[model samples]
Target: MFEWMAWTTPVVVFFTCIVLMLIAMTVWEIRSPTVMRKGLLPIATTRGDRLFIGLLTAAYINLLFVALGEKMMAWFGLEQEPSVWISFALSMLLLSIIMKKG
Candidate 1:
């Protein structure tokens, strides 16, 4: 059914996962309310707030790695494909830290 859409499989999966996470969070909040807490981010945040910040951070991290990684790779004559994996790893680490500490 998604074949006609212009989005790649990864894009579709990413968005689908986001939608599912939002739904899950909504249900979780309905069941048990979240309390605001201060974290390393310097601002008090609830679950949703942290999630929003984490997603935005992950997107920016990926963009930066892709944009700068290409230039750096070209400068050093290195392969470009590994940058994606590196960015993904870094983003995942950041996301986990945010979820745990933020």
Candidate 2:
């Protein structure tokens, strides 16, 4: 059913993480509801809100890495364009930070 999509390992991992996070958040919300609060972000936000923003930011970061990979390699004089794995790691880290402090 999914053969039309590439289904690469990174793609699978990224979507899996997102699905797991959504499930976890749903369970946590049922157990203890989140209250909106202000953090580093200008507006108050609930856990789900933070997660949504973080996910969007992570997606953009990955897109930027893909779009700029060649230019980045040229500037750094690397043997090859930066690996998508590097962007994945960085984007995940950024998501973590947003979830923690957004």
How far is 46's C-alpha from truth in model 2 (Å)?
0.4
Candidate 2: deviation at residue 88, Å?
Answer: 0.7
What would the per-residue lDDT of candidate 1 be over residues 4-101, giving only the tens digit for each residue? 77888798898899899999999999999999999988899998899989888998998998878767777888865445888988998998799779
Give the TM-scores of the predictions, in the order they appear: 0.80, 0.84
Instruction: Show the lowest summed lDDT stretch of 10 residues, model 2.
Output: 6-15
The lDDT for every candidate, in the order shown, is 0.87, 0.92
Model 2, span 1-102: residue lDDT tens: 988986899789868987998899999999999999899998999999999898899889999999999999899999999999999899989989988989
| Native-referenced Cα lDDT, model 2 | 0.92
The parts of candidate 2 lying over 4 Å away from their true place are 1-14
- lDDT score of residue 35 within candidate 1: 93
